[model samples]
Target: MRQFFSKCPVCGNCTTVTSYKCKSCGTEIRGEFEPNEFNNLSKEDLEFLRTYLRNRGNLTKVAERFKISYPTAHSYFNRVLAKLGYLQSESFHYAEILEKLEKDQIDFSTALSLIKEEKEVKP
Candidate 1:
């Protein structure tokens, strides 16, 4: 059986499903079935997502496991997050760090030191 292509061959528009047929009994029934979104994910993206989850969202561990650099692992993770609509802005990261500091999980001195370091790194 030929797999259904999502795009029309002639015009490149999205192809619509109008009907369905059973292979064994020749039974037919169909109208407007939604394709599963998961079907749209490439195998490599799925594998990356799986490995990322398996590593408990640790980029360092993921990099080590895949023999990639930490920056490469972080880039891949950020790309996936962007695809999934979960990417965070720099402001959001700063807010999260502030929240951690407020909760006493990070010391105020450490937070101030990081802020000073970030300022120094800025052009």
Candidate 2:
């Protein structure tokens, strides 16, 4: 697929969509149109989101699809959620973290750090 740029090529900053055209009729519309939110993500982020959606937002399914650990999959999911403005950096899925802690998959200190780290990420 051809990559559509969401950022200004020269300045490396986000670009505004100023116009649109009809492909078949040659009708044109010009204005400050908002770009698609998905366009803001990179190729990798898009693929991750595709897989995540394909799995119905199941973190375990996403991990299996990616052939990765749950924590790793969770990290990717969280990153995308943050980028899309769907998640606050200071917030987390606490139940999952607590479950890991109860199972001894993560120690108390690591669990605390994980929770703390989320708050440290600027919103």
> Model 1, stretches more than 4 Å misplaced?
1-30, 88-123
**lDDT by residue (tens digit), candidate 1, 1-123:** 776656677997667777899899999987986555443445676688888889888878888988877756666666666555567554344555565676678898988887777667666
The C-alpha lDDT values of all candidates are: 0.69, 0.79
| TM value for model 1 | 0.46
lDDT per residue (tens digit) for residues 6-65 in model 2: 888899888877877888999999988766878888899999999888888898998898
TM-score per model over all chains: 0.46, 0.71
| CA deviation > 4 Å runs, candidate 2 | 92-123
